[model samples]
Target: MSPAELAARLTDPALRVVDCRASLQSVSAGREAYATGHVPRASFADLLEDLSGPVVPGKTGRHPLPEVDSFVGKLRRWGISRTHQVVVYDDAGGAFASRLWWMLRWLGHDAVAVLDGGFAAWVAEGWPVTDETVSEPAGDFAATPRGELLIEGRELAELAPTARKVLDARAPERFRGEVEPIDPVAGHIPGAVNLPFAGNLRDGRFLPPPELRARLVAALGGTPPEQAVVYCGSGVTACHDVLAFARAGLPLPRLYAGSWSEWITDPARPTERGDAP
Candidate 1:
């Protein structure tokens, strides 16, 4: 469904609408924004808190996947049931919402979707806003993880060659190892092609399907969706790429959340310099 359609679902009590607006650096702003005003019946979910878990050493990927049981517990605590329709939104279109969308889909829930235009569009549309601080009544929602949706460092490393096409969603400079800000080391995983997440948007909103398809086709060359994986600094922005691909009717790529941040932290994980691929 479109972003506006998702917004229309806001008034539905059965739907769980979450506001995922928060910068990667500052999470407190999300709560404050929610406290001030948010879509009616919408609750605030901190990306790092509600969407991700503590970073594990060595074994898991950079933004290692959250414990399935813990995630299901969080869903239950949020009053989301298996049948509940979930719509996630953020200021940057589906940049953040796409993370929640991917997580839900990975758990085998198909009813979930990212709000197309995000909160900014909602406000622009003159939709109702509330600061009521919604607290969902607890419900039972069990989560079953789908292993195929995840790709560990080793898996990505092995697949980076002939198995799959690695797509880096960071800026060209960052991907090229020219400037490092958040990660200890810049550059990207060897063999990963650069496709900045911003490329998915045109003036803050996502590009139309045809445009997205054309851009992604150009990026992918001939590689099919199953033969591709998308990553970003901490796995947050890469979801934008995944959302774009989905919008373009392409297969969704596996996400590497621990992305560059987690990758550089481990010296054993190989690194590359300059833009070769």
Candidate 2:
């Protein structure tokens, strides 16, 4: 929803707004930002405790999906009922916000949507923000895991290079295997295309749906939605690509939740450097 639309409905009792601003570089930055100011009536969702489970070192990716039963309690604490219209926003585009949007869908809640343009756009438009932390009464949210929406690195490797298209959402430098900043591995999975998530936006807001579809389809290189898989380092920003497809009015692709972090866990798995060829 646009900031104006959300502002008009700011007092709506059924809107469960969440602030998902976060930084991979610093763990506490998001919470600190939320403490300073955020969209009014918005509760902060920590990427570590709220959106992900404890990391298992080399065994699991950096940000593993939280266990559903436990996440249900988290949702209830946020007063996110199954029927509530949940709106999530973040500072860096919709990168972090899209994660929660995808999670809500995986839990079978279709009422969720990411705030286009995110917090940055809201602030730029003069929308009111509050430093007050929000707490809500318990709600009645539940989870029914949509296993089909997710794919692990092991299964992702099983797809023949001819049968699947893996879209990497990291920067060109990261996707090209020319830099190593965060992950232990530098190269991307074999046959992966560089489709950095930043391409989906223009001026922080998503491009118009038709233009977005053109961009996404061009990146897919004629691969049908069902035949494509999306990933990024530890599988966070990839959701931004997935959300872009959704906003573009296309069928969403499965996410490689373990992503490159998990892909490199075993030395036996093949890796390819340089551009997709």
Candidate 3:
């Protein structure tokens, strides 16, 4: 939903707002920002504690998807009922918030939406903000994982000769192994093509449906949307592309939760550099 649309429905009884601000460099920064000020009636959701599970050495990536039961408990804690119209936002465009949005959809909840342009867009409009934190009574949200919406690194590594399109959501430099600010070795999965998450947005908001569809369709080449998969550094920002797919009215692609970080943990995994096939 657009910031303007969200602001207009702030007082609607079924509307729920979540502040998902986070910094890739520092985990505590998002909560600190929320304490300073946020959309009125918004409750903060920490990317580390609330959204991700504990990292498991070389197995789980930096932001492993939380255990379903634990995430369900969080949903209840946040008062996310099955019927609530949930809107999630973050300061870093929709990078972090899209994770929550995708997770909710993966759990079979269809009423969730990422606030286009995120918290920055809200503030830009001079909408009312408050430092006061709010919490609602526990809700009865349940978990029903949709495995089809996800793709694993192992399966992706073997996708050759098949008509699948593996899209990497990292920056071009990272995709080309030119520079990697995070993660061990640079470069992308052997056959994956680059499609930085930023391509889905313009001036902080997502591009219109037709434009997004054209870009994504062109990226997919001859592969169908169902045969497409997306991933990023630690499986976080890739959701931005998934959200864009939905906005484009295209079939949503699968997410590689472990992503590049976990894929590179095993030295035996193949890595390509310089865009050479």
Candidate 4:
């Protein structure tokens, strides 16, 4: 949703705004940003605390998917009901916000949207912001996880390059194994294609649907979205591409939540360097 559209609907009681401004570099960056100032009546969702589950060291990725029941509790505490329209925003494009957007969809809540251009655009447009925090009455949200919306590492390792086309949302350098910043292993899954999430946006806003469809559909390489898989370093930024695909009117693909971090946990899996596929 656009800032103008959100601004117009701020008075609607059923509208919920979430500020998702977490960082990979610093854990407290998102909460610090939220405490500084945010959209009026907007609540904050931290990347580690709210969006991710427990980290199992070598067993899971850096940011594991949060438990469904726990996330449902947070949704209710945020006053999100079955009918609420949710809008999530962040300063770093819509990368972080898309995580919540995808998670809500995974929970079967389809009324959620990422604010186009994110918090930066909201401030750029002279929209109002406040330092005061907001607290709403507890909501009644029931979560229904779509088991089919995910692909395990073992399944991805087996079917990729044959039955499915895997897309990696990490930067070219990381995807190419030229430089490794976060994860111990450098390269991506052997058959995964590079589709950096940043390419989906220009000036912090998503590209037009035609442009996105042109880029994403080509990456699909004749595979249907339902049969495709998307991932990133720890499965956070990949949702940006998923959100972009949705904006382009394509069906949401399965997310490899364990992503490259978990993929490397097993040394038996083949890793390819450079952008060949």
Candidate 5:
């Protein structure tokens, strides 16, 4: 649903709005922004603490998926019941919001959606904002990990060649090794094709599903969606692509959780630069 639609339903008892306004550069930025002004009845979710697990140097990529049990506790604190309609949003397009969206789906919750165009869109529509924080009673939300929806660095080594059409969600420059701002190394996984996450949006909102489907099909050379494996720098924005696939009514692709950051940790793995061959 659009921000307008959500604003209309803001009073619905089953609707739960989460503010995910985070920045990769600063750990406390999101909450700080939320404190100043946010959508009414919205609770803040911190990416570093709430959404991601601890990182182990050379072992786990940045922003590792939170442990299942711990994440369940977070859901309860956020008042996210199984039946509630979840709407996640971030200022940087849906980049951060999609991570939470994908995580919820990985835990078997399908009633979630990203706030189209994010908080900016909501405010742009002249929707009301509040500096007042909300705290709801804890909810009952359990997580059951869906193993098939996730892939680790070890598994990707074998599957990257044939079974998976690894799609890199970083900007084309990052995918092509022209720039490496965040990760240690440049370039992308060999055989991985560039399909930047920005393509999923226009004027800050997601593109129509049919258009998304057409673009993915063109990029994958008609490869079945099940064979698709999506990744970004550290597996966060890759969820944007996964979300796009689902929004397009296509089969959701497996997430390479560790992605390029993890992929480069081991120098033995091959890397490809320039436009994908």
Candidate 6:
């Protein structure tokens, strides 16, 4: 279904709509925004608090996967059962929302989807909003990890040159080693082609299907989707690329969540510079 169609289903009792908006530096702001006004019956989920567990020592990614038990606990607390259809949205298009989408899929819950265009589109459509906070009655949500959906740093490092294309969704400058503010390392994964996550949007909404296909094809140099893997800093923004590719009718790419942050952690992983492979 299209994003708007998915959003229209928000009020449906069978669906669970989650607000996945938390400023990278400020968790309070997202809750404050939600407190002011949020979709009817929607619950809030913090990206850092709910999506990620705890950082491991020597792990370079800005956000590391939470302990599986902790993640499962959070899911159960959210009342996300296996049978429920989960929908997520954020203020920043699907940039952050996609993380929750991906995490659900990784946990083997395929019924989850991101609300395309996010909160902005919802507001623009004159959809009803509520100031009252809603609580989810806790439900059982079992975690069954989907190994195929994820690619770790070593896997990405090993698979980069075998006709498999690695796509970086960070800015062209950051991808090219021009500037970096968050990560200790300055460049991207080796053999990665730059396709910034913002490229997926047009006027705050995702590009229509045909345009999305054209852009993805150009980005891949005609390489088919099956040959590509997508990543961004700490595996967060990369979901935008995943969503874009899916909307473009391309095969889903595995996500490298550790992404640039984890790659740079290991001193032995080779780094690139100056747009030269």
Candidate that would win on TM-score: 4
lDDT of 5 by residue, 36-108 (tens): 9999989998988988999999888888888889989989998999989998898998999999999999999
User: Clashing pairs in model 6?
Assistant: 53-66
Model 3 is weakest, by summed lDDT over 10 consecutive residues, at 155-164
Question: Would you list the clashing residue pairs of candidate 3?
Answer: none
How far is 181's C-alpha from truth in model 1 (Å)? 1.2
TM value for model 6? 0.91
- lDDT of all predictions: 0.79, 0.89, 0.89, 0.92, 0.90, 0.81
For each candidate in turn, give its C-alpha RMSD to the true structure in angstroms. 2.0, 1.0, 1.1, 0.9, 1.0, 2.1
RMSD of 4: 0.9
Model 5 quality (TM-score): 0.97
The residue ranges of model 6 lying beyond 4 angstroms of the native Cα positions read 1-10, 222-224
* lDDT score for residue 85 of model 2: 93
Error of 5 at 206 (Å): 0.9
Which digits, one per residue and each the tens of the lDDT, describe model 3 over residues 1-277? 9889999999887888899999988979999999999999888999999989999988878889989999999898888889899999998779999999999999999899998888888988889999998877778998788999998878877777355788899999999999999887889887788989999989988999999999999888878787789999999999999998999998899999999998998888898887835
What does candidate 4's lDDT look like per residue over 1-277, in tens digits? 9999999999999999999998899999999999999999899999999999999987899999988899999999888998999999999999899999999998899999999998889999999999999987789999888888898998888774677789999989999999999999899888889999999988778999999999999988888998889999998999999998899999999999999999999888899998855
List ranges where model 3 is wrong by over 4 Å.
Answer: none
Give the poorly placed runs of model 1, Cα more than 4 Å off: 1-3, 57-62
